[model samples]
Target: MSQQIPFVDYLVLGENPHLVANECAACGARFFDRRNACAACGATGFRKAQVATAGEVRAFTIVTVAAPGVPVPFVAATIDCEGTSVKANLVKVTPDPEHVKLGMKVRLATHSLGTDSAGTEAIGFGFEPLETAIDGQ
Candidate 1:
């Protein structure tokens, strides 16, 4: 059997998938990328912190145009995951104004992007509506 890998380094792919961030030890600011110093407080220390899987949609936009080969009419959103702002695509729902709204509750979800020649699948993460997640959809 081939192994599955996360598309991003912070995504932990397993029975329970979640994201981790580098948190500033002094200021408590979380960042997904490596940082030598805290941007908010100029702290030089950091620690691994688990990000909340559940979040609220703080803002979103319906993208109708994109680069060639990329799909259009997708929801690009900013989610507030326990006070941390996460920029990710919203999936498993129609990309329309009526369906997606600000302050909508969402939960992290993973999907298989594709497999490589070595048969390793790359998993990507997204946020789905809370209702859909609760219903096991």
Candidate 2:
């Protein structure tokens, strides 16, 4: 049976993207989520801020172990994007995973990890090796 979906968004299409966040007017602060108040100075005014799509891998770990049906040696990294960044898992592209190092530029892309309770998978985006990032081919 087909599952119903609420909304679907496509991120990190061909090039890296801006995860569009908000910046505080009072304090020099930025956040990924939209908020009515400044997290740093409680200012209600904000401006549109875009986070860097491409970033270097700040940190990573080799998962010698994983959950059921998952493969071991998978890599998880904390991407350091411009301004505010987040951690993401590399998918679809592998570039000498063993030699993967911190501060390596990577691109963001959407990956399929099966449906969730909402029956949708594009709820968020993930990072992939820049070598595999789509470039309007």
Candidate 3:
């Protein structure tokens, strides 16, 4: 069997992939990366918070340009998940205005980023259309 790992420390990849953020206990601000102090309130105290899988698109953009070997016309979005805004890629939908819109529901989804020669798989998470999330393809 292949070993599975997350693309980033904040993302937990496996059969049930989920995003974990550090929350400021003082101000209730959530951060995706490790932090010494809270940006919102400068509090040093924090707690690990598992963000909601479902969200609504608060903002987005269709990128037409990217680095070499990177695909273009991908949707990058800010999703409001249980009051926390998470910035991630919007996948499994056409990258068009008609397909992607603000206030559209979405849910966490995982994809294979690549595999190491040692048979370890690196996976990343993104938000996909919520209605189809139940199918879990």
| TM-score between candidate 1 and the true structure | 0.97
**Could you give candidate 2's per-residue lDDT for residues 60-99 as a string of tens digits?**
8767777898876667888887757676676654535565
Q: Which residue pairs show collisions in model 2?
A: none
Lowest summed-lDDT stretch of 10 residues in model 2?
4-13
Q: What TM-score would you give candidate 3 relative to the actual structure?
A: 0.94
lDDT of 3 by residue, 1-137 (tens): 89888888988765667888999999999998789999999999999999998999999999999999999989999999998889999999899999998999999988899999999998888999986676765
Model 3 is weakest, by summed lDDT over 10 consecutive residues, at 128-137
Candidate 2 global lDDT? 0.66
lDDT of 3 at 49: 90
Best by TM-score: 1
| Candidate 2: regions farther than 4 A off | 1-18, 33-44, 67-71, 93-97, 115-123, 134-137
Q: If scored against the real structure, what TM-score would every candidate get?
A: 0.97, 0.63, 0.94
